[model samples]
Target: MITETRVKIDWDSLGFDVVKTKSMFKATCPIDGKWSEGSLVPYGTIQLSPAAGVLNYGQGVFEGTKAFRTVKGDVILFRPDRNAQRMAFSTKRLCIPEMDTEFFLDAVLKTVQDNIDYVPPYGKGSLYIRPIVWGTAPALGVRPVSEYTFMIFVSPVGPYFKGGVKPLNLKVSTQFHRAAAKGIGNAKAIGNYSASLFPLMKAKSEGFDEVIYLDAIDGKRVEELGSANLFIYKEGVIRTPALSGSILEGVTRNSVCRIASDILNIPVEETDVDITDVLKAEEVFCTGTAVVVTPVGKITYQGETTTINGNQMGSVTEKIRQTILAIQRGEMNDPFGWIFPVNQIFKR
Candidate 1:
């Protein structure tokens, strides 16, 4: 059993950077064996061979979720089951052994519980959970490896954007493609993120907060950002790009849609969103586990810039952000059964 030990830190000054916690959960499996019973281990680095399959062929997948210190003095996970399901899908796509959802959830629970002391206070921030799987065995060929490793780690992080909750300025990138059609873009593959780094860096250097990529098939429809899903509210309707086998299926995007339709009684649709629709949108925002619901103040494409909602966060955008935060922090009733109270289920 892992004992809970309090980790002292400057929670008030916490940012999105990784703050190491007490322990991490780890487990391993061979190509012909089942996953071993995982346990909490002291947080540290693991050795890997130079020719490891993950290092050579990029056979790794990762999932992100959050555990919040709620107003009710409880530590709860927000829709972690969805993350587990996505991880399984990603592993299958990468030709790795499919991860059982139960196994994934149990590992996350153990990791979070072991680091329960790092869960920030009710309003400071939430503990970010990252679950990753990779092919660990050394390999010189291009085929599947002989072994795999799955690890879960927790970090206490604040806002993703450094400058508080300000509206973002995004640039439409027609020069690069995030992921190709009929590719592993739908999976949370590590290679997909590696491909996005250059475009994101170039966008940042050009004075944009993020780069929004268009569909790989045709450069007409908007896809998503480097790390978040895009949404536009126009004519009282909310629309995001359809999951066209390229865009990542974001958990926060799904939550925002559900909250819009069920709680706020707003119309929501997932369809092919064109650049023209975004240029004329009443409100624009992006969603992810890290960036929650950050509004896009402006979008620039081909020397033309369009200011959204007069370069301010729209009322509807704020409504969605607040509503989701409320549910996560236990400030409001959870009608969708999303919050998983970990402290209640697993006592210290």
Candidate 2:
């Protein structure tokens, strides 16, 4: 096993970028065989044939979750089971071999434990875990490949957005649709993100932090951000875009809704969020595994920019963010049983 002392990292200056760790977990599934027993491998580049299905046909799916070094000097994962379930969903959707949830969770635990020392000290940052599966067999036809590889890697990262926790300025993109109504937008497929890169980069060039995409069918209802789910608050009620087979069901988004309803006693609704509603919203925010619960300060659509709650993080948004963070850091009681302690899992 590789030890962590071989690498030197400045944890204090960590950003939302990859800081290579000691090892990663890898497992392979043949075309007609089950997944192999995985093991830890050194973090490095992977080789793939030019005619690989994942390269030529875009057959791949990935998941993102974090491991936190809690205040009590123990490492934990927030709702890893949910991530495991999601990965299985994504794999099935992409025509890849379905991974057992237990196998997925076990792989994640082993990978994180091998790189445990890279998990920053409490309050510094988190170990970002990325689990990815791709078709590795070379193929010329537009079909599923003969082999698949599942790998999990970790990186120490800070906030997703620079200047940590500050409200974001977003642009409403009517010209670009994130995912089609019946497409793979619901899955965490690699293609879904590639489609957003152009729009996202354009939004950044326009002095916006991110882009908010609308539904592809009618283009009237708000779908989600480039990489996060959208939320808006009005009249003491919290609402997000409904999961209408076009939106990715985010783990953080679900957690936010649950926390708002159960802990904060705020009403949460998943329905069609129109552009008009977003304009009139008193509060706007986005959630994801990486972005977490971040406030939207301003929203611009069709030449008009609406400032949300005087361009600051709303009280409700702040409350929800704090509550989730507290629970994640083990500073508050986890009424939802979302926290998964790594040490406890290892003991078993």
lDDT of each: 0.92, 0.91
lDDT, candidate 1, 243-303, per-residue tens: 9999999999999999999999999999999999999999999999999999999999997
lDDT of 2 at 335: 95
lDDT leader = 1
Give me the runs in candidate 1 sitting further than 4 Å from their true place.
1-5, 344-348
Give the per-residue lDDT digits (tens) of candidate 2, residues 316-346.
9999999989988889999998899997764
Model 2, which residues run further than 4 Å from truth? 1-7, 346-348
